[model samples]
Target: MGDLSLVRALGRGNIPVAVTTSERQSKVGFSRYCVAVVPTPSWVDDPEAALAAVIAWSEQQREPPVLFYQGDHDLLAASRGRERMAGHLRCVLPPAELVENLVDKQRFAAFAERRKLPVPLTRTLCRGK
Candidate 1:
């Protein structure tokens, strides 16, 4: 869904884009906005390897490209390994702490409540006590 949105938004603006995916089967590569597709390991499966692959992919470009992450795993890894990837690619990501807070929904709920953010009321029911 994110890929489709990106293709539509960027393609309409005539912005060049390249996509990367661990699964060669990913249909995002077929999008009209995609100029190229670089293959990389799934961050969830092998974070270190994926990070290496991404950095290498960036190095091949004459200029660093703005990265667009598709999921929590990619976002977290990007935030944690920002320095390494920063040398070769431009990325816009939340700080590590914010990523952690969001990734762990419990922390996010507490934060939202503290900040008085509008969120649906939630209940935690214990299985047994």
Candidate 2:
């Protein structure tokens, strides 16, 4: 859903966009809205396999496409496989380590503290407190 809006916005700015998904269900139908729809692999259990599938699929494209990974798992997997996927497509995501930190609340909090950035005070909840 968010990708569709992003693509529409990018289209408005005259930027080419391609949408990729693993699901058979179509969230956004192609009707002069975007460039193309590419189907990658689903990462329900094995994320590495999904990343490899996307990398292979991307490599077959005539032109290198700008890649935008939506899910965290996808982002992580893509980052891990970035070297192999670099020439095929450009991914707009941070490094794997950065993504890992972002996904982990504890790590993010520690990072903020180390960088002297403000972080919300959080408390652990206990049963029958």
* Model 2 stretches with alpha carbons more than 4 Å out: 124-129
C-alpha positional error of residue 125 in candidate 2 after TM-score superposition, expressed in Å = 5.8
Model 1's number of clashes is: 0
Count of clashing pairs, candidate 2 = 0
lDDT of 2 at 48: 73
Off by over 4 Å in 1: 124-128
* Residue 3 C-alpha lDDT in model 2: 68
What local lDDT does model 2 show for residue 10? 78
Per-prediction TM-score: 0.83, 0.76
Which is the leading candidate under lDDT? 1
Q: 1-129, model 2: which lDDT tens digit per residue?
A: 126777787788998666666766656546356666666666556777776766666677787777776777777777777887778878677767888888777788877778888778756568999
lDDT string for model 1 (12-125, tens) is 899888877788777888887878877888788877678778788888888887888888888887888888887687888878888988887788888789999998876666
